[model samples]
Structures are given as structure tokens and as C-alpha cells.
Target: MAQLSDDCFAFGGPLMSIDDAVGIITAKVSAVTETETLPLIAADGRILAGDIAAPLPLPPFTNSAVDGYAVRASDLPAEGEATFVVTGRVPAGSAAATPVPAAHAVRIFTGAPMPGGADTVFMQEDVRVDEDGRVVLPAGLKPGANVRPAGEDMANGVVALRAGQRMRPQHVAVAAAFGLTSLAVRRRIRVAVFSTGDELASPGASRAPAQLYDSNRFMLMAMLKRLGCGVSDLGIFSDERAPLAASLREVASQHDLLLTTGGVSTGEEDHVKAAVESVGSLVLWRMAIKPGRPVAMGIISGTPFIGLPGNPVASFVTFVHVVRPTVLALAGALPEALTPKPVRAAFSYKKKAGRREYVRVSLRSAADGSFEAVKFPREGAGLLSSLIETDGLAELGEDITKVEPGQSVGFLSYAELI
Candidate 1:
């Protein structure tokens, strides 16, 4: 946990750029102090505590890439077909007892180790077997056609996975291939979530006049869960200072990060910002991004605080673009692994130059063998239907004043980020 200075909230200057704001939040994030050793089966989606070096080569031996006959590449006929005696058969997991001599071949199956004195494999389909178990090479047969050299996949003593690498299914499989039963992984960050507003009620609750059911919490929780975080739900908070302040202080010391929706703006009823200021420092108040402009980032008694907008889409967008990366960094993941590559925009839209905009759009392939993006009809921050119909956000940069049709722009896919 890291604390923000009181000078963080004193400035009333222009709203910070999205990049600068992200830098500030990430700079204040502290890595978690906990760690755990988990079995390979439980290591998926966890961050590696240290680099993993290969103890043995991936295949561990030179092997055949196809079911074929192993022979020395120099022994093959230069012009046409050649004949050889098939001395023995070697399937996978069995070692060749005798070395394959010149002008002789050994029947080998896929994954079977290459015999000594043999450096090439001819596919079984390209050869004819005579009654006496002789192999006849076909015309145009090339040497080394199907041999897989040892250490081609991985060499011993090589770094298989780097420290701070987030484990995926493929990573687990690689570790298992090296006979690793377990891995040292950083503990998942514990996060507590709540939404603050008098007009906000939980979904399925009766709504009074001018009241709207809270949707940000559910969306935030889903995003956090997808990021492999341990989440605690605090439901909704009222507009008063006592309960809100008490709740903030109580949960601050218990979790690595505290996330809330609403109550950070300058509205009269907004108390979350004030409560945070009294207990901690609000590092950032606003960003130059559309829909999620009211985003706030701060530190409370060493625990990081993220305040998202109450709007359903805004909360989700901000979480994906900003808080998601911050949480990942705090969990000890590499910075490059946090954000995804910007995809080329499929469709064109309009926006002002100074501020960044993220438009929800669906992606489909065009007849010209490229992705054609189609924007959703509704762009409201509170409309859940817009997100339902879109695949992800098309990030319009802060430089371009106008975008014309057929021009490529940056896009962020939901499947990639979430």
C-alpha cells in the first residue's frame, strides 16, 4: 500500500490527460505482500512469482515428426528412387536398440526418437513396403523431410517463462511438460466494492420516485472477477458522511484495493470524494475520456481507491481501460501484459479532437478480406443495450479532428481486455 500526498487533491487545474492520469494511478499502486505456491492445475490466471527455467529440453530427445522411415540424409539417392532394408520398428516411447546403418532404414512413428546415425525421415505415404519389409523411396523424395531435432521446441537451462508473467493454460501446459508440479505465484489482490448514491437501489429492489437501480456494482464485480481478483461486495452506500466514512475506514485496512461507483463528482450529495480526502488523498479526479469523464483515483491509508462513474457503461469502460491495468500492476503482473493492442477501427464515427472517445461497435469481416466495424445505434453511457449489441470499444484518439469512412483507427475488443 502507498499513500498519496495532500497536494494531490489541492490542485484545481485542467482535467488530466488519460495517459497522465493512468501513470499517476499506476505510480501510486503498491504490490501485494502475500504469495502462494499453487499446483499447476490451480496456477491458471495467476501471476508467476519468479522466472521458470527449463530443466530439460521440451521433447528431451531428437524425434520423428511423422510416421516414416528414418535414414541418413546422405544415404538417399540423388536422382530417383532408392531401396533400403527396414531393420526394425520404433514407436513412441521406445529407444532404438541398434544404430541405423547406411543404405538401411528403421520404421519410426510420430514422436518416436530418431535412431543414432540417422538424420532424416521419409514419410510412410511416399514409400512402398515390399513383401520382405523393404522400403522403396519415391521420386522427388527429399532428405530431412520429417525429422524433429532435439531442443527445437525448448532447450535445457533456457528461461521458459519470465518473472511476472501471468499464467495461462498454455503456460501451465508448458510447465507440466517440464515435469513441474507447482509454481510460485503472487496472491490475488483482495478488492471490496460498493456504490454510493441515495437515488441508487439494488437491482430487483423496489424503486421510488427519481430512483434508479444500481447497475455499476454488478458490472464492476464481473470485470474484477474476470481479472482473477478476490472480491467483497458492500452493496450500496447512502449520501451521509458518517456511514460512508466509517465504511471506507473499516474496509481500507482489510483489502489491497477499494472500488466504488458514484459519489466522487462535485454534486451536492457526493460524499465519497470528501470522505476519501478526509482519510486519504484523491490522486486524480477527472480524465479527458468520454462516458467515463468523472473517474477518480486515490490512496486511502495505503490501499488504492478507484471511484468509477455511476453510469453503467461508463463504469465498465473505465474499469476496462484504467482500473483494470492498475489492479493488474498491483498484483505483480508485467505492464505490457495489462493493456491490449489497439485494433483497427472497422467503421468511422465523429468526435472532437481534444478529448478521447470510445465507441461501442461490432466487428465483422468484409468481402475484401478485412474487418468492417459497425457502430451501435445508441451511444448513451447509461444504456446497457448498447454494450449488449457491441463487441468492444473503438478508441478514437485525441489528435484527429474528424475521421472519414474506410480509414483505420484504434479499437479495443472486449474479449481481449476482459
Candidate 2:
């Protein structure tokens, strides 16, 4: 856990833009310093603690890139084919006993080390074998045509993977190629997640007349787990100042971050914001965004906290676009992984100026061979099914008010986010 300066609340005057909010979080948040060693098989999704350099040059020796006959380019005649004696054979795992001499060729396979004095490889298709155990070589073949030099893939003593990288499968493969069985990675982030509202009840339990099942808690917990965080579910708590403050203080000491839903707005029953302020500090950021504008970020003791809106769709969207990056930052992962791609708009949309908006859209292939973002028929933060029915969100910028069909727009797909 890390603490921010007391002046974090200084930028508290207006609804902050999405970019400004992200900048603030990136500037103020510090990554967890603790690290642990894990086997390469278990290192996926973990943040690297340090750079990994190649132990030796990749391939370690010059080899043939294809199954061919290793030969000297000079053996081929200037304008006609030349016959060469087949001296020896070399497969992928074995090396030639002696250097190839003039007018002689070595039978070679893919990945076989290139024999000395043989600078080119003629693929089996380009060479003809005779009954007398001789190879007829073609003319005009360039030297080093099918040979892979040592260190071609990676150089020795060079950084193969850098610090703060999230170890993907390909990254792990690189480590394995370098003969590393284990890797040093940042420890899994510990998270405490809860829902705040008396009107919320557990999903399996019978609910009272006006009570709704608590979906945000499970959602937050699953999302945290997907990010490789060690999450503790605090469950649902009533909107009371005393207990809420006490719980906040208790969990602050145990987890690296606190996540809650439903008590960030300025409504009368929204006590989570006040409770956080009483226990430590809270900056209510009325974000200049649609669906989930009321977000609270702060610190208690030293643990960071993020409060999200109660609506299921809003919680999902905010967590994907905002809290996901915050988690990556805290875990020491690269930030570029969160960038969304662009897609053409399939339907027209008109939005108000000064507020960014996200609309659920399913992609449809147009006659022009480009994918178009088709907006879902219904729009509401509380409608959870909207997320299930759509492929992704069509992100509309704050400066843009109207988007016509076929216009390019930034899109964030659930596949990428999840």
C-alpha cells in the first residue's frame, strides 16, 4: 500500500475529464514493491519484477533453416549444373564429422548445424540425387540463402523482456527458451470488495419487497481475480456511518486496495463517501462521463480505495475502463495494454457536448468488408443484459456531439477488456 500527498484533493473543483482522471491516477499511484519467485508455468498474468536477459545467443550455432543439402557455392558451375559427391549426412540433432570439401555436399535437415566450408543450403527440391550417391547442384544459388546464423533470433546479453511487463504466454516462452524455469514477478495484489446498501441482499437468499440482489460484489471479485488479484469479499454493508467507517479502517490494514459500489453518489443514503472521509480521505470525482460519473477515489491509512456507481452496467463499464488500469498500475504492469481500438460506427448517434459516453454495440460486417458498431436497442445503467447482448462499447469522445453511420469511432471490446 502507498499513500498520496494531502493535496490530492486540490483538483476537486469541477467534473474531471477521463484523460485528466487517468493522468491523476497514473501520476499519484505507486506500484507494489514486493516480489516473489514463481515457476514459469504459473507466471502468466503476473507482472515481471526485473528485466530478463538472454543467457546465450539464440540457436547457439549456425544452422540450416530448411531441409537441404549443405554445399559450397563455388561448387556450382557458372552457367551449368555441377555434380557433387555426397560425403556425409547431418540431421537436426547431429553434426557433420568433418568440413565439406570442394565438389562434395552434406545431406542436411532443418535445424541441423551448417557444416564448415558450406555457406549455402540448396533445398531438397532444387537438388537431384543420382544412383551413384552424388548430388546435382543448381547454378546461381546465392550464398547463405537458407542458413540461419548464430544469434539471429536473439543476441546474448541483451534484454529479452523488461521489468514491469505482464508475463504473457509468449513472454514465458522466451524465458523458457533461455532455460529459465522460474521468474521473479510482483506479488499478487490483495483486494477487498464490497457492496454498500441496505436494499441489497445476497443472490441465493430470499429478498425483501424492495431489496435487490447484490451483483456488483461478485462482479468486482471476479474481475479482480481475472487480474490475478487476491480478493476478499466484504459482502454487503448497510449505509451506516459508524460500521462503514470501522469496516473501512479494518480492511485498509489487510488489503492493498478497497473497492465498493452504491455509496459514491451524493444521495442522502450514500454513506460510503462520508465514511471514507471520516476514516481517511475521499475525493469525489464527478467524472465528465456518462453512465458512471460519480466515482470516489481516496486513501485510508495507506491503502487505496475506489468507489463505483451501483448500477450493474455502470459498475462493469467503470471497472473495465478505469479500475482495470488502476489495478495494472498498482501491479506494475505496462499501461499500453489497456488501449482500445477503433471501429466504424454502424448506427448514427447524437450526444451532448462536454461529457464522454459509452454505448453497448454489437459488430456487424458491412458489404464493404468492414465491421460496424451497431448500438443495442436499450440503454440504461441498471440493465445488466445490455452487456450480455452486445459485443463491445462504442466510446464517444467529449468533443464530438454527433456521429454518422460509417464514421470511425473508438471501440473497446469485452474480449480485449476481459
Off by more than 4 A, model 2: none
21-121: candidate 1 lDDT, tens digit per residue: 77766775667757899989899988899999999997889999999899988888778888899898899999899899889999999999999999889
Measured against the true structure, the TM-scores of the candidates, in listed sequence, are: 0.94, 0.94
Tens digit of lDDT per residue, candidate 2, span 1-418?
Answer: 7556555644658789877888788777788899999999999989999999999999789999999799888777788888889889999999988999988899999999999999899999988999997988878788789999999999999999999898889999999999999999999988899988879899998899999888889988998888889899888888789998999999898888899887877777788888988989888888888889988888898788899988889889888767888888888888855465788887888998999998999998888888889999886899988988999888888999999987999888887885
Which residue pairs clash in candidate 2? Answer: none
For candidate 1, the 10 contiguous residues with the lowest summed lDDT are 2-11
Error of 2 at 40 (Å): 1.4
| Cα lDDT, model 1, residue 130 | 83
lDDT of each: 0.82, 0.87
